[model samples]
Target: MTPRLALADMAATVSSEDLSNLQLLLKAPSKDAVRDVCLQSHRAPSRRLAEATAATLGVPVSQAAELVRSLHVLSHHVLFYNLSSPEQILALFPESFHSSLKNLITKILLENSPTWRTEAVSDQISLPQLKDLDWRVDMVTGSDSVSRMSVPTCLVQLQMEDPCPTAGGESVSTVTVELSRESLDTILDGLGRIRDQLSVVAGK
Candidate 1:
């Protein structure tokens, strides 16, 4: 419950009004109903769901909607911190919360924790993976005057797999870099040093 944990910090974000609504929403007779609203909030808000929840809690629809939003954000915070235990989840509540209110919050988080965790993991942005590397050497033979100037250049292309690419769209992207001989040699030297370091590590 220390401020070091983000859940504790997020717990401080709840206003007194929202906290009151949350307490009422959790104290509803049917725990399943409360859990359903919390889970739906994770996806998207629905007016029908809010209205129904409002009726169940005998509060205004606005209050019910706000409760759902608070629960949604709270659940996300819980997932972010990967807090699994009821005690850890309960840390989001004020110390003044009675045992029943604390128990309800813990129950809601524990019941939906697995699904929330799975969604969180799946929502992570994947880093692009290197798929292929291509290089070509070209000789630049002259400029406008044709003074017999010759310079070698290397073109390198890096192809990477696009993680979480759009549906039915290209999943690969290429980056090209042109390097003069001097720059190319510097790159080769760096690569050589990396290879040597890797060899040393492998030997060890």
Candidate 2:
């Protein structure tokens, strides 16, 4: 499936050390062990899960915990990238990882993808969102021909809603920000870079 997340550029963010830890971790846990650890990650506290994982994998608690963390980081990155199938995961991770490690990573990500997607949706719905955006252009014109010149500016008003607001607080907030031509051009340039990055990631 195509990726749903805007991809906070996870491919660049995940480190070589993280992948190495995950590779080592794959050799330690059986498929069933990995399934249980993934389930426990959603339910248990960090320390408890680490201890349980340590005992299950017969590794030191710190090492086990680190492995679990690495697994999670990689899993989320996989999910965010929407690399659902083994082929897609391999495509993204090939050369760096061997076949077996890639297979296991794919399996773990598949097992956890559904729940992660649900949680991501719920998280997004709970946050503030922009309801409407209104904007206008204004010009400053000098009075006489001797001083006749025009400067233009844009004013933007945003209507935002907090789906879950603090007690006794307003659910909707109005904010206005001003953007000069230069600042607007800078913002547009930044947006262009982001668009190009997405296109590259999507193989467009």
Across 137-180, the per-residue lDDT of candidate 2 in tens digits comes to: 97756546543357677888999999878889999999998788
Top-lDDT structure, candidate number:
1
Q: Name the regions of candidate 2 deviating beyond 4 angstroms.
A: 1-12, 24-29, 42-45, 92-98, 125-162, 167-204
Q: Lowest summed-lDDT stretch of 10 residues in model 2?
A: 5-14
Per-candidate total of colliding backbone pairs? 0, 0
The lDDT of each candidate is 0.74, 0.70
Across 73-115, the per-residue lDDT of candidate 1 in tens digits comes to: 6776676666789878777677776667668777877888787
Looking at model 1, the pairs that clash are none
RMSD of each: 5.3, 9.2
On TM-score, the candidate that comes out on top is: 1
